[model samples]
Target: MAGYATRVKADIARWREAGLIDPATAEALTRDVAANERASLSFGSILAMMAALLFGAAILIFVAANWEAIPRLARVVALFAVIAAGYVGGAVMKTRDHAAIGEALWIVAAAAFGGSIALIGQIYHLSGDEASALVTWCAGAALAAVALRSNPLTVAAVGIADAWLFLKGFDFFGRAEFLHFFIVMAIVLFAVSFWTRSQASRHLIILSVLFYLVLLVGDYDTLRIAVPLLIGSALLFAAAVFAGDPIDRILQLGGRLPLHALLGFLTGIAMIQFELADESTYASGFAVASIVALSGIVAAIMLAGRESRGLRWLAYAGFAFELAIIYSVTLQSMLDTAGFFLAAALLLGILALVIIRVEKRMRAAAHTGAAA
Candidate 1:
């Protein structure tokens, strides 16, 4: 949005030169664009992310290797030292306007929290279960994110939460159920995303959820996983398409969740379709795929994609990919189903052209009426 607004500001300057607007209007436009630019992430955020990853890796490797010269207690104490130094340094840097460095240090502190959990657990010869330690680390990160409003820490919290669920969710409550933990962690991560108002954190949350679901697929059958994914896509598509204005307004910061969820779900379903390419299921899959694909494109354009460039492009790609899959599966059926797909694409193309023409005419009529 900042980039687009900046380009529009440049266009406005050109328009001012062309006498399309006055100097005052140009200045006002430039100010609005500048404000939009302020809404974007700073170079510091990117720098902090990079620094956190680099330093965090270094800390993990050192701890994971366990230098025998340093006693286990000393090693654990050193990790705690890092935690204190990082947080204290981050607080001082924050006060000194070194926000990026502060954030990076905070990330280091949070990561050290996790490392400390592991080291402390090992020192005590605690139960080998990983979930408890992960939860403790996640709790620390989550507390820091909320207290400091740190986006990177929120992402780390989400990652920790996802890992904990993936590793021990099945047997956590002695119930051996995965969905329970998934549901709980999802609520926490999503709440953090909104609270932080960080686009990167939100996308990281999506990536975490996608990772969990794909991992679930690894542990289960393709069709069983595909069924839930397809169902989820249908739900998102339906809500995106038919939801009222109030609901759409509430989804303003959802970014690409609706669109990408559809992508993940449909892609999984497509994989299943390829695996189970039988006559009965193939025909049904084709019908389901076409409907979901078309509906997804329309919903993306009208609801999610209108405001999001990434989602719009992803929708276009998904639609095109679905067409390819449909064509591939139908080619063996004597070109009958393939022909249907081609004809449908042709019809949709014609309809799009017609809509464009109508929109152009309507704009022209509006301009004429304004002049009159």
Candidate 2:
């Protein structure tokens, strides 16, 4: 069968080199043919499967025997024991390096066994306080991850532990006192972000910032506090814009700006709701002015950096937002919401024409330069 498969591959390669098949088509065919060969297992694969079965049975029996009196520490110890045994068995069987289907199955089995042990402990009320237990479990899992060089499991454990900590900290206490905790969490997340270069850690940091915003601004009736948040959000957006990579820049910038906008919009609505317009009007005006100013700054940066699409989007969003505010103010005076529809149509038409003319000029310049 191996010889037959090799011959088939050779024939395909010949056809590819002869220009009888496109490169992508040939590559796809090669992958399809290779897929079947990977399914075939050897003696080592069978041994790995048997070891996995025995390990699973041992874990099940251990859990069943201790079903009535297993303390949290005992359950933890038993789980570690199973993991250690599995690692040793895999190491001894020399099946660790096998790249076959059965090896993958056994690896999955090991992971499942570990996860099941943790779940069983939780089910039996042996996991203790959620925060403490999660921390302990995450620490253990992290150690195992380092030892086994398993990144996915490490990330999973870290995420679970962090989530548990956040929930525990946030629910019991409001954001005022929780500021310190969130800061610490952010530092930890930042460290993890750099260490693993994982997007999840970065996202966690962003979330921490959002939580900080809520804590700081949720109950405030003052602009002094809110203005700083708007500034911080603007700075964050600016940093994202100036980032080296386009995709990362967009993601980071996009994530923070919407929150900034939402917070600003909601704060405006809240001020209206509470009739705190006298104090809030100044803040609202300041925020709008700041947004307009920042929009131009971002546009300038984008244009200077030759980022056409990003600049265009930023400019359009800024324009639309300002126009919406104008329409809203007019609607309040006219008591006619239908007027906003006309204003929107006019704004959109003007924007569309401007964009088209700009694009046409750009194209014309490009063509002229090319001809030159």
Candidate 3:
């Protein structure tokens, strides 16, 4: 939203200079955009968040250093006191219109809540594993995020949840139940993201889901998991593209969902290619993988290149990687290598020509419509 406001203001300036609008209208538009722009983390807010984290860490360390000297009851009182102070201070700051500082303080409170969970568990010799602790911490962070609608806290919750899943990567084969719990947690986090409007949390959720799929492939039948992953990612990317406007209306994610989906799609493609390379069906798999990779990159560029710079860059990287893989896989035979490159060059050249013509026609149509 901040980027959008900045671009809108720049366009307004250009329009004013081009005599497309009067100075008064330009000023009014700029003011309206600025007024309506959503609040984003400024440099100070980021620094405040960092400082709050450090402060929370320091307090935890201090208590740990003096754990033996501090009585159990005092320790409990002190923990609650810090938590109360943080929330109270945050409320006061928000009432005073210091929203950035308020959010930082709220984050501090959330951190304290997590720390208290651990310290209290230790003090009482509570019976639980690291996974359970992480779940508890994530739940605390998520509650604070919901209560305050805090993006930072929501991000913290998702981060904690992903950390739990990452740890489970080491031992997920036996704990099949973890998959069900993880899916439920992911769904809850996704729901909380919509409530908090946390884009970072949404990105983390997508990445975590992909990570879980990778873990499944590592533990189970690779072909079964990889094939479904590829199909699912493709479907997800298609939906994100074709139904983008409606999704954005509901999720308010600013078209970022498609980029994340594309990442998953590319990852799935890479995974499948590796699996195929390990099998006896190498030749057919290579051909199919090359075609899919190249076509996916070209389609991405043609669909979203102008509107999304990130998508364009991702496509470029994917194209380079695809070519490199093709060269490496066919390195044994010089003829195969040369033929592959030649074919790829010809096909891409044809795609380039088609894309150029399509873009030209679209631009001409847009101009005609505007002129009318």
Best by lDDT: 3
- Residue-pair clashes per prediction, in order, are 0, 0, 0
Model 2 residue 15 CA deviation in Å: 21
Tens digits of per-residue lDDT for model 2, 1-372: 355568879988999999999989989888888887534456876776566556566655655565457676666666656566655654454354543333333354455454555556656656455455455555555554445544333454456555654665566423234334545645554554444434554555555555555555544654555556556555544554455356455344333443343334333333332333233333455334534443443444333334344444545565555556544444444543355446445755676687679989999999999999
Give per-residue lDDT, candidate 2, residue 260. Answer: 40
Give the 10-residue window scoring lowest on summed lDDT in candidate 2: 268-277
The lDDT ranking, best first, is: 3, 1, 2
Ten residues in a row with the worst lDDT in model 1?
244-253
> lDDT of model 2 at residue 151?
32
Model 1 gets an lDDT of 0.72
CA displacement after TM-score superposition, residue 55 of candidate 1 (Å): 1.9
Residue pairs with colliding backbones in model 3 are none
lDDT of 3: 0.82
Candidates' C-alpha lDDT:
0.72, 0.52, 0.82
Predicted candidate 2, C-alpha RMSD: 10.6
The candidate maximizing TM-score is 3
Model 3: number of backbone collisions: 0
Better of 2 and 3 by lDDT: 3
Cα lDDT over the full model 2: 0.52
Q: How do the predictions measure up, each by TM-score?
A: 0.79, 0.50, 0.90
Across residues 1-372, which tens digit of lDDT does each residue of candidate 1 receive? 446777898899999999999999999989887776655557877877698878887887766666567888788879989999988898899999887889899999998888777767766777855666777888899888888888778888888887776666454545355544665766786787667765666666666666667667656786787777777776766665566345445644444556666676567667566555665524666566565557556645755666667777877887777777676667767566756767777867886787689879999999999999
Q: What's the TM for model 3?
A: 0.90
Q: What is the lDDT of residue 18 in candidate 2?
A: 100
